[model samples]
Target: MTKQSRLIFRNKIFFRLWMAQSGSSLGDWFNHVALAATTLSLTQSPTAMGLVLLCRDLPQVTLSFLAGPLLDRFSKRLMMYISDLVRALVAIVFIWAALEQQMWAFYTGSVLMGIASSVFGPARNATIPGVVAEKDITEANSWTVATSGVLSVVGAAFGGLVSTVVQPAIAFAVNAFSYIWSAAWILITKWKEVTREQDKEESSSYFAELREGFTLLKENRIIMALICTSVAFAIMSGPYFVMIPVLGDLIYNLGGIGIGLLYVADGLAFILSASLVGRVVGNNVTSAHRWYGWGFVIQAAFFVAFAFSTNVWAGMIFIFLSQLGAGILLTLGMTILQMTVSPEVRGRIFAIDHTVDTGVKQLSLLISGPAISLLGSPIVGMIVGVIGGFAGISWWYVSNRERKNVSQTSEPYQI
Candidate 1:
């Protein structure tokens, strides 16, 4: 590898954190399949599956902002360790619930897992910039995005098989073990403990800290716009998760294993696209913005194609291709946030971002059953495609206007 590529791996702290993140993400997907399969097997209701996702998401919507202040005030490493430990325990709960045939226990475990993840997600994101060199911020994010996608391929595909043949409880047990392993990895990281002196001087109350995060979003037009873009992306892409099983089982007649392949295909595409995006747009803020905006347009195109496809294989191909756009948008958005935001309030900003992004996606999932019932899956895809198209257009307009303003500022004075 080139020196630039080697920089992130060479940094021992970032490398360990990256590996830990990979393991944790792999476990997350594993739990994702296990929980969904187990829930459906027990309740025989899609609504139950929706509720499962909602339980995980509700905490993010409600506590996402609150978690921000705590993340900023506390040590990120400590928060991560605690979060992983809690999630690991929750995973074990799922295993026990599955083995015991207690549906309520499974639901309770899922909710607890969600609550822990709400804290973990923001804390983990907030820690990245501090762990790597300033110049390597974009590269680090690229690697992270790619790592997630690659591991997702492994987690989703194999996790499905394990859940199907061996038993979902076994998959949940594996997931629990993965989180414990992640916590151990975090324990070894040499993060300097964050003292509260800085926070004490900066803010007086928890509410004040929360309000400060809101003000920052209001004051920064670019960041605010990006957040809006993420919301649009979330809404557009969110229903796919709900639809994938329907496509695999009802439409394609391939069942659980087919749904797994669909997820794997998406991940593989994302990994390839993220790598290319990292190489092309590395450290180029302007280029990153341009690519980020264009990515939405690409996503829209693929969504439309996917909606139109009658063949299951064709739909899978489209889903895979669409994630290329997703990969670019996600990688650039994260890199921009890490590079631009002040480290002090970075946790809150990430919290806000995650809250909006995830909350909307979960909300989409919750409403999807009704939406699909009313409009049918094909029409729902079209709706998402239209929304994605509008998002892309607006993003392009905003980004181009910013470019014009910058150009005008740099131009020589007229007579």
Candidate 2:
């Protein structure tokens, strides 16, 4: 770790939260690896596997009704651990699903876990500024992303290994344990959220609070530009991950282990990009825009390459480069959002972000699942990949104009 990053770990609460989430996130990959492998093993259809992803995303869309205001009005800290606990139970349901080979149980567990994650994500993002100094936010997010990269590799590889040698049930069990572990650590992290006067009055009505947040979309061009970039990435994301399994299983003729290795490559991208991504966005927050565009352009190029790859080795290389770009996009995008939004409306803004991101992604999943059967993964992926490049260029241009406009009209935006 660098001297700058040393400060984040120096805060015990942040450290514990970081460690706990790292473990929890790793478990999430295990669940992902297991779910994909199990679904393929049972159904023998890539479309079915894509539907599994759709099931996981549905709650993010459906439950936005409750997630936004609850996040703002309730203790975000409480929401965090409770989400963890709910997911633990959901994991147990997955274990039963694996044992019984019941597809419904798996889908049900996915929807339940999605509901839990919907709350946890905003709560955690909204909670971060409360834990550390504003200046440390970039490095703090880097470590979080980096550690996730490391854990994802471990989780994907080990989850693959367990599914291949032992059973998918074992992987499901690990996910359960990981959630319990995260909940325990989260309880130890003390998060103090101060309610602003505007927050207090708005707390009286959910729609009023929600409407207050959506108003930012019209008022802030930066948020609008970010939303555009987010949608492009969301479009890429739906096909990108869904097709990875198709690449491993059908194209490369690799089995469960192969699927896992493909994800390991993606995880490695995050680990490789995290430090450099942090440095790029460090202190000079405005720098994130150009880099964000470049990240997407790079990812877009390699995504096409990965889609047509003929061998596992080539596929891994393409996937790694593609996701390296994605890692940059993800880190920069998240940090910019965190730095730009205030605590008063942070949850609603993030909820809107998730809703838009997931909504687009779900459509991608809906199309790609069947398209993979018709046009094949490469064509489906290529179409989306080409669009991503344009999105990157357009988003960068818009953001620059928005920044100039905001600088002219208003006070500066900061976390």
Candidate 3:
């Protein structure tokens, strides 16, 4: 692409959206470290940490549909701004609670942040298509994914360093500031709202509008398959993430620094994979599907390797590849959904997608600790890895068959 073409691809609207998401992601890492540290410091229990995570995801499960209607009813930019503002206030409350030594306040703040996230999730996904040209959508999504990956590494590493040098409360306060900064940047952007007229026509009944999204999902076999695949992926992969800290404490003996390093490793891998895949796949569905299948195979293998590694370096290397695979798969999934779904129902579909995915992760977090306690980390890890591997193989086989069927059907009907 020429310089001008490249510049158009990196349009102002795209940059603004990227900035907002990057800021939020940066703050998210800080929030995670602060929350985990606070709970561990105060309660000194792995189960408590898991419970806190559960609280964070419970709202997604309960309020996801509500979020969809709200996103449909309001301007996405406005909703995003509000979400950031709410999270900022939640962070402030957390800072105060930490200062006051109030445990409940911390939990309350965490739940409130979760609510903000629940609201933000659909709005953010819905807003992406508005900011970039149709031809650039895949690249745009890839950049978004890549930016998030880089931020995750930077944020986690920075959070750990800052938390170690100063205090968790201060780290959280910095996170709050990031939200404020993001909101301000969002306010300066002038992207026109792309409202779904289908949604506007049904404004008379919110529940009816919400039901339409679910109805669409119910009727679409491909979408249903995608959602189910995502759910399975979540269930198989989720507990391992929740178990990272526990792994750090029990298996690695690395503490907060160790946890942060593992996260950084994963994030770095994701960034590299996202960047490469974005260029390679571009807007080609066939290429995306092929890479996604291969990525899953690699991801599952890496997870098994990660489970067996005795050294931090070996574990980090495997975890990095696992995340790389995940990043590619996720980018492909999101792009496919966005391209295939109607704008009218996209918000709700994404909301349900996020809700189910997060719900499975939360449920996994709830059981992971006990499972590890009983089965041992290595055994539990092996089980999860095996399941993921089987699922990946199934996904590849099914997708390949579908691709062949589509090609065969299209041949006779070609123009």
Candidate 4:
């Protein structure tokens, strides 16, 4: 990023927000490993692992519809604050569950966290334009991705080692503490939300306002295309939900530690790939889809390689490369929405986008867990790779030919 963009974006408001987000994200991978490893140890069944993911995703998918309207009409920062605190309080359940080896409590905590995350995502994205200039939005988002990537690397390694050496309960406690840390930072961050006069007046009922967001999304060809792009990413990422247990029970057999090693590679790749892609794709909102498609292609290619790996350590390199591509695709997709969408509906749009992302991922997990039990992780991974590869290729083709293709030129719905 340019010095000017950096200076503008790193103002006190966003800096605090970033610090808060980083604190929470630090626990993300740890939570993933802790939950998955414990599930595997407790049940030794892929079916049970699938249930864990279902619990984690169902709330986000179901509640994001409601969260969209709330984000648009309410204070995004305040919503985030409450969400952090709620997550912190509820995360205590994870510690107790880990200590007691209770899957029901573990799933319950996942449900609560998912609800918080559903609100947090759109609220955070919608808050960005308020915190930074339009021109600097991409830079700001890039910085966000870069910082998260860096933290993910350490978080994955530290989380994995701790879960292996110390205990899953310790990781669970860190997750709870991270939420408190996030709540503290967000509590003090300054935010100035810009709203439409109609919104301020509350002229419309809840359903009407929701209809407005839906209509905008339906009429906007560009937005739908961008949203469709997330499908491939969803498929690419779905593996994360199931692979931990698979790696533990079937692959390297190192259990939680093996899964951690996999993510360490993924997290390391996330740092470099996301940072580099952010710089390369900076401010090029129009071309975001092209890079997103290409990133998926790269991700799919290596994911296939990862599926065929002879051992865990060799597979780690492929895992690194696969997530490198993931980092690029997800960063581009998110930056595009932040920079191009209207502020009034950005929250709703983000909600819909996230819903689609998570919904598709959950579907894949539904398929993956059953199939893995039937066929094994390698075969299931190959099948997903094929699906993602085809989807990524088609998306790239359409995006690359935008200027020449008549359908690609269709104007987006005007607000």
Q: For model 1, how does the per-residue alpha-carbon lDDT over 229-300 read when each residue is reduced to its tens digit?
A: 999988986677777777777777888667777887788888888778868987776787788877888877
After superposing candidate 1, which stretches have Cα over 4 Å from the reference? 2-5, 192-203, 252-258, 400-415
Judge candidate 1 against the unseen true structure and give its global Cα lDDT, from 0 to 1: 0.81
Task: Identify the leading candidate in terms of lDDT.
Answer: 2
Best by TM-score: 1
lDDT of 1 at 405: 69
How close is every model to the real structure, measured as TM-score?
0.90, 0.88, 0.88, 0.83
lDDT tens readout by residue for model 4, 103-192 = 888778788888998999788888887787666665676677667768876877788788889999998889889989988998767667
Q: Model 3: clashing residue pairs?
A: none
| Model 4, C-alpha of 368: deviation from truth (Å) | 1.3
**Candidate 2 ranges beyond 4 A from true positions:** 1-5, 35-54, 93-107, 196-203, 249-261, 372-382
Candidate 3 shows a clash count of 0
Candidate 3, superposed: residue stretches over 4 Å from native: 1-9, 42-50, 198-204, 242-249, 252-261, 397-415
Stretches of candidate 4 exceeding 4 Å from the true structure: 1-9, 33-53, 93-107, 160-170, 199-202, 240-258, 312-314, 372-382, 397-415
Itemize residue pairs with steric clashes in candidate 2: none
User: Which sequence of candidate numbers ranks them by TM-score, best first?
Assistant: 1, 3, 2, 4
Instruction: Pick out the ten consecutive residues of candidate 2 with the lowest summed lDDT.
Output: 194-203
